[model samples]
Structure formats: structure tokens, C-alpha cells
Target: MRVDLHPFAGIGWPGRERCGPMRRCLPQLRDSRVGIFGVGSALAPHVSRQLDLLPALVPALEHGSPRERLARRIFDNACIDERRFCIPDFRHGTRKVLYDTLHPGLGRRMAVYRREAPRLAASACEPALKSARVAADEITHLVVVTCTGIFTPGPDVELAERLSLQSDVERTIVGFMGCSGAFHGMRVARRAALERNARVLLVCVELCSLHQRDEAGAGALVAQSIFADGATAVVLGAIRDHDRTLALLGEDRTCLEPGTRAALTWEMRDDGFAVRLSPELPSLVEGRVARFVTPLLDGIDPQVRPAWIVHPGGAAILRAVQRGLGLERDDLASAWSVLRRLGNTSSSAVLYVLEEALARLAVGAEGVMLGFGPGLTFEALRFQRGPGV
Candidate 1:
């Protein structure tokens, strides 16, 4: 195997002292054939269907203000039937714990994240390891991706210990990359496997509910209505004689759209993080979807329509992708089902849809996965189903 040395392999990078202890060598996975051996996901225990939760939220939002009206419209059109939350009180009608005078500080939110993220990661990882028929110590690397929480001794380290991985296993934490983070994680794992021939464990866990703000504005209300908590784990390695799952062949990412930099943003605040979502986000994506994505899709196969596994940013975002790709609604049934059941689990959203798609994907079927994030970026992965799941 050709092991590519990172730039700072032996000698630390300049200004390394200024960086935090959590910093490590950059992941140097290069282009190679990597098999996705297994995928497993876990949802928080607290669940609430939309029918019960939306009515309960009416009182928290203004009874008749424009924000309230906008929230009602957003929720009515959300197409999400239910979502799971790590916080018990956010379930359905129990709004007083979070919505009433509860401006949870950043510290409190981080505390919850530190406590819950590892458990969720473990819950997902265990099943994945089992499916891959691999043990904890056999994992040569651990990669954890998240956008909702920040803490030293972060989820990556915690998950490694929780799973009893080797003390010196290479580690990486791809943080704050927004909804598209999971795709980045997959790329990282693919590289690790292809470069060093290492089996990589990848986990993406987000507790978006922990960063909730009680603000009554359209952005806050809309974010609250759609975001939730979930985690997913996948085992990746170089394709071998025994490897027979979906193989990640290649990926494409688009440059940020002009003047749309701030369309979707996640910012840290003293009293938890604030989400700034533009109402025009759907339209912006729709306008550029074809131009940005058609080339990528055509590169995979000009004649065949690969299954479109899209990120469930929301109802509108999914529709925008569909219209952009000239795909029918039925083409996005898995994406819609994930959104309806799990809401947008931030970085885990696309993986959830991929898991649903994997179950029904037939051998010889081609696939295209897409995710959008803060850069107004679009990330796509092209893959083909192997003989076995």
C-alpha cells in the first residue's frame, strides 16, 4: 500500500502551539477503491409526531403575529410527520421546559452534547461493527463528524474509548461542516482505506435540539420546526475478496454560488447557536441545481437515471433538488420518508436517506447522492451496489 505522509507527519505544523489539544494530523485519504461495509443509525428515544407537536408549538409562537403565521405555514408544508429529540421535554406538548424562559447557555448545550453524543455514537457504531464482522481493536481509525456541538475531548476521542479501540488509532473529527459534513466524512474514510489500507470507523452524531433558541423569529421557529437529533455509523475499508457492499467510486463538490454565501448559516452564540436560514434558499438551489449537478450526473452515466439520494434539508429543498434534476417525486421517496420520520438530523440527514435507499437498491443499480450546506455547496457521491448488502 502507498501510504501518503501528511505535510506535518513528523514535524508539527507552524503555529501548532496556538492550536488546541484536539488538533491532529490532517486526514490524507486519497483516491482509491473503498467499500462501504456497513451502515447503522440510531435515533434519540424522545419522539413526537407532527400532528401533536405543531399544535403544541402554536402557543409558543405568537397566536396571530406574522412569525406565528409563517411558522404555521412552514410547519404545515414541512412534510415531516415526526422527529426524535435527545431532550425529553421537547417531545410534543411539554414546551415549558425549553420554550418558557429557557435560554439555555452555550455551556449547558455543550454539556448535554458531551454527555449524549458518545452514547448515540456508540449505539450506532456497535451495530455497524457487528455487521462488518469487525472488532473494536481492529478499527485502525475513528472519524466523528458533527456541526451542533463543540468541546475538547470531543466525540471522536470519546467514541474511540467507548468502543475500546486501540489507544493509538488515528482519529479525526470533522466539525461544523453543516448538513454536508457526512459526505465529507465518507470521503475521509474512503481515503483512509485507500491510502493506508486501514479499516475506518465513521460516525456522525448531531443533537441539533440542544442548540435550540426560544426566539420567536421566522428563522428560529423554522429551524426548531425541522431540526432534530440522530446519529449514524459506517465501517469502511479497501475492497477485498470478501467485501461485497456498495463501493464509493468517486465524488464531486461545486463551488459556492455567488452572493448566496449567507443563505444558510449556523453560528455559535453565548446562549446557544443561532441559525440564519433565508426564505430564498429553496429558490437559489433550484436555480443552480441543474447546472451544478447535471455535469456530475452525466459523468456517472449519461443514459441511465441513477437513484437520487438527496439531503432532506426540508420539504422545499428536496423539491428543489427534484425539479433541478428533472426527477419525479417517486424518485425521492426515500429522502421524503427520512424527512417525514426523522426531520433533518443535520450531518446525519443524507446518511439516513442512504440507509433507506440501500435496503431497496438492486445489484447493478447506479446511485447518486447529494447534500447542500453553508458554502451554498453541493456534494455528490457516485456509487454502485455490490452483489451483497
Candidate 2:
């Protein structure tokens, strides 16, 4: 279904007439009062223009080889216009010529991540806090999620300092969960928002560029073609008076397509992490997503057909999910927009899609946010647009 990103976009349900009657009639919407007040996302300054990627990949490909042709074809067909990067050289520089000589070890990559990830996280979070009218000191818990980079005094610790959050604020960092990692963080914030006097801040940041490798294999080429750096922040709390936000409804998490574990995997190597994406992943998802997502929506009220906010892991994944769910292309417009504009920002991607979806949502509108990661895992959360400011 097509979703419009505007204040007066969807069918309106005035005042308590929105959730009050629906909650009683449909138990699924009964207790969903927690809301997301604001969402902010930021891309790094270094951008790879639309035509820059193919030329950059050309030098990496082996001359006069079939594999090289395949690599070029993959990059050409990735459906990405441009992508921002945390590493300057990955953008418009001579890095292509020096790529073979540059072997950034794990230590070097970690150094860059430790120095930059928090800055990007804070940049995204500050505006969210301001937009929500939430003071840094007022936030009781902080949740940071990432799988791209790891270093102590992690982004969580540094963000608390950078954002000037309270000294005793509770903090949690979710690591190595790949793209769906932010869903785990959102789940944490969802629980925190349920507590009295608690305001939650969730930050998702990924410096996928720092993990770039010189390998020209299919997996590496796929990783290089799609991954980019980005950060997003979300403010969540129990619904308050006059709050214009999206309600935090129930969530469902599951591991699907067993024995397909080798289809997608991410592991740490000496020179950054490695990604192995089997060619079968897209078709596997296409075949299984319907069964996987159907149960998540089964118990919800049939009248509240939630809009879909899917993680655009790649163009293929988006197409796979759309067919699996019997949805039209417009249903995934936000996802496609984010992927074309920013590529896959790993864990921060779903948050970007959510931000866009919420922007277009009208009061009492419902939506579903889905993300996939390692373990062939799927994280799905149901949300409803609540009252306006």
C-alpha cells in the first residue's frame, strides 16, 4: 500500500476515539501507549557520486577475467545512486590506485572507529533530543547499537559524554548483530519507556567504510557496492499529553530458514570484518518471508493494516520482501528511497526507514518495521501513529 509522508496523510481517528474503542475491540492495540517522539539520521560528509563507484571498482577487478566482468555487473546493478562514507578516501580520491597497497589492519580500523563513530552518533542524536524537546540530562537510559566497528569506551560511553547526558545514566551497547542490531536496541528502549519518569534515547551508527577490503570476490564486491556509513537516533517514552509521535506496539523476533546459516555470515578478520553472502539469499528470502512475517501480523487487529517499513538491505531483498508479503512497490517506497540515497547503513537502516515512515504517517495510522541480520534472523515491531503536538 502507498503511504504518504505528511501530517494529514492517512485516515484520521479523532482523540480517544482513535485508540480507546480500537483497544477494547482489538486486544493487540490495548496496551500500546509508549511512543517515539522524534527520529534523526545523519550521513557522513564523504559521498560517492552516482558514477564514481563503477570506475573505482574497475581497477580492483582483474583484467581480462570473467570474475572481473561479474564484479562490474554486480556494482552496476546494485541500484544505489550514491552513498556517504566515514572514510574520505572511499569517496572521490586516489584510493582506487592505492587500494591494493592499503591493508588497514583491525587495529587501524578500530582506531578510526573509536575516533569517529561517537561523533556521528552525537550528531544524529542532538537534533532528535532537540526535536523531542528532551534535554540530554532528562534521558534516563541510552542504547547504542552497531556491528560495523568495536572499540572500548564504545560509542555508548563516548556519546553520553558528547551529548552531555547525566553521569549516572544507564547505558547498553548491542554488538555483532549485523543490520538488525538496532531492532534489539529499540526493544530495550521500548521497555525503558514503559517505566515511570523514564525517557529513552537510542542511537544506531555504522562506519561500514572502515571495514572495506581490497578483495574483488563476489561477497566483497557486494559488500563494497552497498554498505555505507550513517547514524540515526530515536527518542522513545510513554505517551504524554499532546505528544505527536508513533506508539511502540508489540514486537516479534524469530530465526527463519534453518540450515541456511551459511547463506549470510559476518565474521571478524585481521583487516576488518568479512561478509559472505551466498547467491541464494535473495531467493531464499523470497520463498520464506511470507511464512516468517505472516505470524507476526496474524494476531494484530485486521482493521489496523499497518504500513510496512522494511530494511533495504539491497534492491533484491526489498523485491523479495514485497513479493513475499504480496505488497505493491509503493509499500516499500521509503525503503527504496533510503537505499538509493544512502545505500545500506547496516544497523541504522531500519531507523532511517522508520523516520521516513513516521514523517508521512497520520494520527492513528499503523506500521510494521522489519530488519534482517545474521542467524537469518528477523526483527519486527508494530507501531501506531499517536496524537499530534
Candidate 3:
């Protein structure tokens, strides 16, 4: 709350003499991998009505067999039907039926980076970096995170070299952490800072839509429609004084419905990626969310501010989040804006929500960044603003 809560917390810090408290907090943050921002990419097959999922889910529908009956039952009662998703189909003809969406080849990946990385760097990370920039030879550690491709030479190395980061600067790559990977990366960065007193840079890039599947059933379509791609890069540094606009606030997390793993699944295949989404998902969230999340929000004030920065999995998913969290329509405006502008960007979506929350919501207010994936589980982090957080 000192970093986030106390600001609007109705409890102001008593003095500029924060040395004792900051010392206690600084060491804890040293290697905590505790915080960050989000980046995202667009969905592949580009979410069009021209493509169809009804045919894919009920392949033998035209044959009129018992399988069709089973398919009907599955579709009628499943999340797909209830969610009103049109399988968010694709437009590729050659790639259609062969796979969901095209995985980026090296050339294609470079093409995306060409247009995206520069603009993103200029717009997001660069501003933060510029805010925190210092004389040369100061930055000591860098952490790059992503989960959407294959490459031995990897984007991290390419990014560092391109940016002219110090040649000997310590660099690390975090891969395959999934939607919650950035948090996982923060864990790693926190450790690095704690051990070496290293200044760290966390970069997130996920072209989520690149992993979309084409001829899959409703599950794949739904997941792909809601998941887009983008990148986020931020610098977390240590400062003796509180003059810096940004500061780390306390953070807490939890998992839910551990047994519900079958609710959502993501796996790679020769045809791209296959996902199985169950209709029981929203209900799972509705039932368990309050129990799981409320505890996480236990000490926070809900009356003055109960804002939420939920990863917008999709339009329906947002609806589920609102109902589950017991929030009114206006509580998650930032989340909706990101979802409307950029689909779910996996791990980065939460970061995008955080960015939105920081920019749009009142400072020092409490908010939750929540997401759910294959675990059929929920992951949430409670946060208040950092200094200028």
C-alpha cells in the first residue's frame, strides 16, 4: 500500500524520510521478479466470418451418423454455443483445412518484427526506458520473455544486438511460460537483481494469433479468436530515493479449481496448435472466482475502489469475469478497451490491463490482474500503483 495503496488509500505517508521502510522493501524487491507491463499481437487467420467451425466440429454431419448426434450434443451444451462465438474463423484457402493458422517461418517472423518491434519499442518500452535512462554502462541485466515460436538464435539476442545494449550486459531468455509467463519471468528477474544487484529489463513478445489452428473444432476457434499477439518491455531498476515516478508495490497471487484442467488445453501439432475448450468454463469461473479471488483481495477496500484489470480472454470471457468478481459494468473499462483494440495477447494481456489501469484509473487504487488457461484454473495478482506506477 505504501507504493500503491497509501497514495489514494486515505492514509498518506507521514514524511519524506522513507529510508527505513524503503530499505526493508528494496531488498525484498531485489530478486522478486515482482512486476511488469504487457505486449500483444493480432489473431491469425484474422477472425473472419467467411470461415466455418460447424463443419469442422461435426465433420461427418453431412453423412448423418451417430457421430453427428454426439457432435450435436457437444455443440448444443458446450461453451461454444453458450458463448455465441462463430468459431471466429479464418480466411486462408491453402492453409485452411491443412492447419489452423500459419506458424511464422523465419522470414515471416522477421516481417512481423520489422513492423511491430520498432513501433512497439518507440511507443511502450522506449518511453519507460527513456524515463529511466542513465549514462552508458549502467544497466546490468535483461530478461526477454515470449512463447510463440522456434528459434535457436532467438529474438532476445537479436533484440539486444539491435538495440546496442552493452555487449557484456548479462542477458537471459524466458520461454514457453504461456499466458502467465511474464510473471514467471519477473520471478527470474527478481532473483537476478537480488543476487547481483543487477538492473533488469523485462521484455515480452507474443504473436499469439500465430499459433491459431484452422480446421479445428469450436474450442480452437474460440481460443484463437480471443488470443492476439503483441510485445511489452520494461526496465525495473533500484533507486535509493523515492524521486523516481515508478516504484514497486506489494503483490500476491493464487490458483483456482485445480481439478478443472480439462477445461482448456493448448498443444502444438503439425497443423499448428490444437485447443480443447469446455463449455463448463464460465460456470467454473462464476462459482469459484469469488472464493479464490476475494481471499486475494482480502485486505483491500472494495467500496472506494474495486477496479479489476482482467486479461480480456474474449467478449464472453469478460462477461464471465464481471459476474465472477461481482463487479459492475464500469469496473473494467480498461480491460474492455484492450480486448476491443487488441485481442487476448496471452501473458501480455495482463500487462496491457496493468498499463491501461495505470493510465486510466486513479493512482494508488487497488486492482487485480487475472487470467485463466489450461489449468482450468485462475491466476490473479493484487496490486496498487507504484510511484507513478
Candidate 4:
């Protein structure tokens, strides 16, 4: 069975010390041949060059004009450049790099994914399926994780049938966990690994482009510019006898700073999931996330040769994590690319970083996976690469 687990990693407050005090423990983790799978997602409803979107861009709209300037300043601080989705403008950038889409963040449940899933699957999902297929003919379990859309009996069922997977393969759908939902899905898949003694596929797709909010004010504008759409699927399954396997180590969940609930919240709005982002998020993350990390990576090592898989929630969030974690400039290099390339794909974003870490980094590199969302919750994973020993 595969252990799809990352216990304590996030976009904020990533500490070099927290990444297991440095060095890939592949030499010590005991399991080195574990296999992990992934796909870089692409979604549609392509945003052709975004224009001067307001409302969501400025905060004063929500509270009125008394604080317009101050709100704009807050949004500006997020340090964003022009934001857009895969859609080409009247005639945008190169078609090869830029994805064509109508906007994945548009409709509700089925419509949203139905509208965008085909594109995402075509670009990201199909490849992941092939990667997994190289190793297993039968997918014992299918875990679909998403925060962007919801379909009554979700895409997992559809994907299973499409993949020629056995009808009896266990299916689990995790929805609306926001950007951190992949962690939750993987956590559940970890359990499925034990129960079924089988292969499992964990899919995380977030068409942030679809749920694009109007740039109401600075906060919304920064948010609108910063978040984009994408998806990633990781395959985790135990090798029959390989001791050095990519194994799902474990997972940890923490609810920190309860009073800050109003700071970060995602509510259903007619347009889509209108995110009620509070200014309190950054500082809140700075203050409480450190405590969460100390406990999660404790047993591994404390000397600090830790590797990191941070969610590219935003460049600011990455900064917040760096300042809090005492990490080096390269600590979150992968995360930055994900953001620069894909913006924020909601829940799927963090795992995208994890996928990068798994591919480029060597096995003994210690890693801490982290992501944040509503409920003022922080989900972390303490893990390292698989089977490369």
C-alpha cells in the first residue's frame, strides 16, 4: 500500500529547521521504492488578458469608501503583476505556453468542472493516468480532491470508468476544503491504502480561473490577479518488495488562532465561491504556524537540514513562511514557479509544489508540506522523496 501523506507543510512560515533539520533521509526512511504520480493541470474559460477588474480588487467596496486608500494599499502589498488564465487575449502570448480556456472558475458543481474538467484532464489528468498506468494495471482506489467545483457523484466515477478501472474500485470524493483539500484527500487515501491493500490515485484539481471573483477592491483585485486555475494528481502505491519506496509517511492537521476565523473564509456565491479573505491571514499564519511545525517535524531531526514543499498561495505568503521559518532564498523556489506559472490553483496548488520537490530533489532531502485556507486551519506533512536509494 502507498502512504500518500505530507504532515506539516504550508506556504507560510516554512522553516529550514522544520524540513527535518536537513538531508534526505532516504538512507534512513526504510522505504525508498515508493512510487508517486502527478500531472501539471491546465483549465479553460481561458482569461484573455484581464482588464481593469475592480470591486474584488479594492476592499473599500465591501466596507464602503471611508477606507479606500488604505484598502488599496493592503491589496497592493501582495506584490502582484498582471494576472490572467490560460485563455489567449484577442491574440495574447504564445499558444504553446498559454492555455486556451473560457474560465474554469465559472459555474456551479458539475457545470464548473464539466466546463473546465475536459481541458484540465486533457492537459494534466491524462498524463498522470499514464504515469500511474506504467506501474499498475489495476487502480485499487480512486480519491478525487478538489475545491473548485462539485458534481453530485464527482469526476472520480467518471474517471474510473474512463480509465477502464474496475467498477468495484473504492471511490472517495473530497470537496470544498479550499486550497488545503489535497492534504485531506491524501490523508484519507492513506487510510484506504491500509484497508484495501491496494493501489490508490489521488487527484487534486482547482480551476481557480473558473471561480474568479470580480476585482471588487484591492483585496479582491490582488486575489483575482494572484489566483489561477490548474490541477495535479499524485499516484501512491507500495512496491511489492522494494524497501526503498516512496511511502506515505504520515499526516497532521491543526486548527490555529480561532479568533481569526473572519480573516479567511470561502462562501458560496452565485458567481462562484466568493472568497472572503481577511487581512488578518498573514500575521495569523506567522504567529501560529511555527508552533504547528515544531511538533510535526520533531521526531525526524532538529538540526535543520530540512527541505520544503510550500504552497504557492501567493508570493507574500511565501515571504511570510520564509520569515517565520528561517529558510534560505532557495527554500521555496519550486513554489514560486508554480505561482508565477499557474497562479493559485486553490487546494491543488500546494501539492503542485510537492510534486516538484519529489521530481527534482533527491530522496534524502527532508521536506515539510504546508497549506492554509478557511477555518484558519493549517495542514502540514513531514515527508521526504521515495525509492531513489
Candidate 5:
């Protein structure tokens, strides 16, 4: 199912009347009312390692082996210089090796997640609340997004306790959506803020490092070379007078490209969650992104050139989107910066780019964020800087 939400203009759902011209929609809010008030991010505590050390760090890529050679090539071309991990063994030698046999049981991995995810998530959320100038008791809703790990009495419950949020704060979790998960969480947060006039706290945290496997195959190698661990949080609410927030301008209909379900897949296995990335995925994005983005662009004023916040799934995916949309390299600088420094943090990756873009966006500037996930699904959120800074 696809959803096109432009609250200030009007919403477009299947079987509903399509949104009219901007002139007809402009008076609904006088100006955008709902928006992102603040953003904060945190990385796993372990120090990062350069790409060159990965073979030595991961046992699956033993020196002088075929996998090691393949990994080196992929890492060199990945455009990533360093990546962090929650597991200290990735950067420092430890007798208790996590991926000793390339097959750590799912139970073992999840145990690590249950212990660490909440701490990292809380670290991110605290600063987000501080930056938004909203106290813990003021949050009316909580939304958490993740694809890396799961447990009952999950991170959502722990986050509230760690942050001292009220016991009655509404909570929701968006899981297993892969890289596009943040957009899905934002969609939910937008609804809560608009429908209930709520102050929503959205947290996206991924422990991708825990899923690294020593399995053989180009797909596994590529995934290993580019995935990392990180968390990001954003506070959403009604834009106040003279606020310098990123207003929710609109959201385009989400599209699932046909016949591409296998292009990207994240599955849970006896060992742990595994990611399979088809080499053809980049080309698929290049072929479809323009058509996917056209309708959303048509809804906006033609004179405005919106900034592009495409997810940096990898260098290839970023280039594909840039080529498809006729965008310049500078258009995606924020994405590339994140990819180079942190690798792909899966669900939290796009928000890192959004945090960077927030610092550079001029008052009244507009931008679009795009994310892709397991279903070969593409999601888009349109936003603009509110009037006063």
C-alpha cells in the first residue's frame, strides 16, 4: 500500500480525491505547522577501524584466502574509510570472539543486542530532547525503529525507563523494514503529531555489526564491507512561532518496484540475521528513481530546487540516484560524508544524513529524503526549513 501525505496541502490516499494545485492547498495551515524540532545521533562505544584492517579483524576473511581478496576489493571500492562496532573485537583483540566461527547463534547475538541497544538508544534520545528543548515528561509519543535485533520487553520499554519518560507515554515500534525503516517511523510520528497534536520522539537504532557473518558469497562480503552500528533520534511536534525546524511539507506515495523482491533481502537464520544484496540493485534504482520522484516534484512550486537527501546505501546507490535525477555531486555531499565516516548503519543511516543536512540548509530551503529497503520499496519525505531561524 502507498501513502501520499501533505497535511498542509491535503492527503492523497488510494480511492480518495487527488490533491489539487498549491494555490488551493496553501491556506490550510497559513504555513507548515508540524516539523522536526531537533536531531541527535550516537555511535557504538568501540573505536572505529580503517577498511584495511577488516580482514585482520574478522575471522571469516582469513589472510591469503579468496574471501579476504574479495573483501579487500569491495572495501577499497566501498568509499568507506572507517566503521564502528559495538563488539570491541572488531577493533581490538579479545579472547571472547563474537564471530569466532562465522556462525554465532541468533540467541548469542540477541543477548548482545538486549544488553547494548537500549544504552545506545538512550544516549541518542537524551540529546535530541535537550536540543528540541522538550523535557522527558513533555513527550506524548515514542516511536522506535530497528532491524538488527529483537527481544520481548524490548528496547522500547528500556528507553522510557532510561530516559525517565512518563509511564503513560504512547509507544510504537517499526521493525525489519531494513534501510527504509526510518522513513516509516517518521511517517508514524507525523501522524501522531498532526492527528493528536502530540510531541513525538522518534529513535532509530541499528546494531548491524552483530549480524556480520563469515559466510561465503559475494552478497555476504558486500554486506560485511559496508554495514556498521549506530543510532539516531529526532523530536517532532507542531512548529512554534519563529521556530527554525524542518517543516513537514509533504510525503510522496511509497513505491515498490516490480519483480525486484530479491534485490535486497534481510533474513533471520540459525546463526543470526543475514543480508543479501544483489549487484543489480543499483541499476534498478537508477532505472526507476526518476519516475518515482516525478509526481512529488510536480506537486511543488517549479521554481524551487529542493536539496536531495538520498540514502547512502553505498557509493553505487548514491551515484545511481544522482544520475537518475540529474543531480550534481554537491547535491549528495551529506550522504557521502556519512557513508565514508560510518558505513551504512541501516535504518539509522538516513537520519545521519538528515542531521548533517540540517546544519547546512538555509532558512526557507526545501529538501526531499529518499530511502530503500528489503521489499525493493522506495519511500520519500518532503520537508522545508521554517521561516525564522
Candidate 6:
């Protein structure tokens, strides 16, 4: 019954200059006890390509030209040992390459997404429901998050069918928010739980590999080097007696860095979605993240150091956050570990980090989750380990 309410208690949305638009304050839900009860994740199983195989899989990286050499260096230092892909052609010796002189078009890529995303979602959701000790029929709400694909009768519908969720389950899709998509989904889940004591199932699935381009530009190189495929699911509801969970503390309004609308973007192109990440992104995040994040910690006891579950955008971004917050590498170990193990699975990445953090946190431990995406937007969630954890 000990609820920590300092972070978001009675905080209104910031002005347009600060947060992009006028908006109502997030509901404080002081009387409700929403919390994440279970976490599960699954990776695409078709191809597990190592960093060294990149030059072979993508001929553009094999050339010894200056741009290609630099791309190779980026690949080498990506902090990723291997990345899973739903596309089998991403492997080194595929008989038919998906990305030849002409890369796969958007339609083809989305076809793969439609086929694979639901299966991956179910793979993650099954374990999530099992761990939450909730049955499929008990779920009253479903929140699906993704940025890699889109089509009519999307993964949301397919996932419900695959999982045998109730036909009446209210569904919401948090799409195209990029890496922070899961945070939005979590927000929806929390709101539903608070409003109706709803049992909410949240799923994030990204097939970043489906959007790969053969271009040799810095942005393309970086995106290809770090992006991968995975899905993660979480079950949330009113905190139950004797339940071990990460109690939802509060969430900050989306902070859009001024004049950074173009710093990072995922845009649709004929050949799948094209990602453009400016080299200045790391420094931009480092310079502004502290200012944006400090308010959430305003009334927190200065002596208490909370765990950080950061989206692993890349090595540079992780190091920047560490330096900005003056945190030790150990503080962001889960982020780094996920990056090394799964590359950047976009929306699912932060939840993967959260899963890792959950295993290590002790009872009553508090943690902050940070995710950055398009709009150069920043999403922050504050949570604590509930009693009986």
C-alpha cells in the first residue's frame, strides 16, 4: 500500500515550445495500483548474422572504397555481436539475395511483416500471459506497438486471433513511433488499467531487417549495422496482493527536442522504409537529456539511485546518456547487454532491457525507463518494485 507519487503528482503538460503542443496532464491515478506483471520476448529465427558476415551479405560493405571502409568500421564498432532477421537472405550465402542491384520494395517487405509479425507477437505474448498468471480470456485490452510494417487487418487483429483473445477485447495500435512505440503502448495499458481495472496485454514487434536498404550513406550504414528484429510483450493490471511487479509510478509527457525534428527519422521509401540518423544525435541527446529528465526526479530522495532501463539506440547514444546522467557503465548494463545481444530491435528494445533489469532489481527498487524515437522525441517512465516482489 506504499505508493510513491512524487514524480508525476499533479504535473501539467509543458507549453507548446517545450512539448510541441498543448495537452492535458496525464491522469495521476493515485488511487489505482497499475503495474507490469509479466515480461516475455522472442527474436526472429530465420537468420542470425554476425558482424563479420555483413561484408558478404551486403556487397556494398565489401568494397574497399572510403565510404564502404567507414561503413565497415561502423559495423565493427556497433557493439552488436549478431542480429536476428526474419529474412533468410540476410544470411551470408543465400542462393537468392533479397537486396540485389534492386532492393526489395515496400510491398514485399511489408508482406514479410504481415506474415511474421503476428507469429512473433504470439511467441512473446504466450509466455507473458503465462508469467502474469493470466489467461487469454482474462485480457480485456490489447495494445500493439510497431514501426516496421503496416497493412489492413494488421498484426493487432492477427495476434488476437492467434492468442485466442476475446473478440470484444479493446485494441489500440501505437504504430510508427519508432523505438519509443512501446512506451506509448505502456501508457495506454496503464491508462486502461487505472480506468477500469483492466487486464491489458501490451505487445511490441519490430522487423527492422525488413526495412534494410542497400545504400552506402552513413545513415543507411548505421541503420543496417544496428537494427534487427524482435518482439516483446508485457501484461499489466491493478497490482494484486502478494504479486511481484514493477509498479507503475508515473510517465513524463513526450519531450520533443526543439529544432530536432529531422535529427532522426524513419521515412517510407520505394525500397522499404529508410532510416536517417544524423551524426549529431548522440551529442544532441547528451546535451538535452539531463535537462528533460531532471524534472521527473525533482522530489525523489537525492540519496536513492534508481536503476535505468534505456533503449539501446546504439553504443554512442548509450555512452552519451551515461555521461549526461553521470552514471557508471554498470547502471546501464542491461541496455548495453541487450544491444550486444539483439542489436536494436526498435520498439521492443526497451522492454528487452526492462526484462533484464527486472531479473536484477531487489524489492522496492525504483527504475527509470527512457526511449528516444522520431521527432527526436523522448519518453520516460518511472516505476518501482512492488511489495512481495
lDDT of each residue in 1-389, candidate 3, tens digit only: 33232222222232222211211222233333333322222222234321233453324344456654444544433222111111232332534422233343444544554444434433345544654554224557778777665565666566666566788878777766577666666656756665444567777766654444444355544564455556665666544443343435345454635578777776766544555768787777766665555444445544566567776666667777777655665777887777666666766677667666776656556666677756765666555555553
Error of 6 at 222 (Å): 1.0
Candidate numbers sorted by TM-score from highest down: 6, 5, 2, 1, 4, 3
After superposition, the stretches of candidate 1 with alpha carbons farther than 4 Å from their true spots are: 1-32, 54-60, 64-67, 92-101, 299-303
Minimal lDDT window, size 10, model 4: 1-10
Residue-wise C-alpha lDDT for candidate 4, range 196-295, written one tens digit per residue = 4577777776766556543455456557656766667766666555434443454354454457778777777765677777666777777666655655
For residue 231, model 3's alpha carbon misses the true position, in angstroms, by 1.1
Q: Best candidate per TM-score, number?
A: 6
Clashing pairs in 6: none
Comparing 2 and 5 on lDDT, the stronger one: 5
State how far residue 188 of model 1 sits from its true place (Å).
Answer: 1.6
Q: List where candidate 5 sits over 4 angstroms from the true fold.
A: 1-30, 56-58, 65-67, 95-97, 100-102, 240-244, 299-304, 387-389
How big is the positional error of residue 199 in model 5, measured in Å on the Cα after superposition? Answer: 0.5
Task: List model 2 lDDT by residue over 1-389, tens digit each.
Answer: 22222221122223222112122233365466777887788879778864576555345666658977777678778888899977667555455322444676888788888888998999999988987888999999999999988877778889998999999899999888888898888878888888898999999999887776768777777877888899999888887666666555654545544667888899999977888888888887776665455544545556555688899899889988877676778889999999999999999998889888777888777777888888787667766776643
Q: Provide the lowest-lDDT 10-residue window in model 5.
A: 15-24
- Output the worst ten-in-a-row residue range by lDDT, candidate 2: 15-24
TM-score of each: 0.87, 0.87, 0.69, 0.76, 0.89, 0.90
lDDT of 3 at 99: 27
| Model 5 clashing residue pairs (backbone) | none
Q: After superposition, how far is residue 237 of candidate 1 from its true place, in Å?
A: 1.0
Cα deviation in Å at residue 389, candidate 6? 6.0
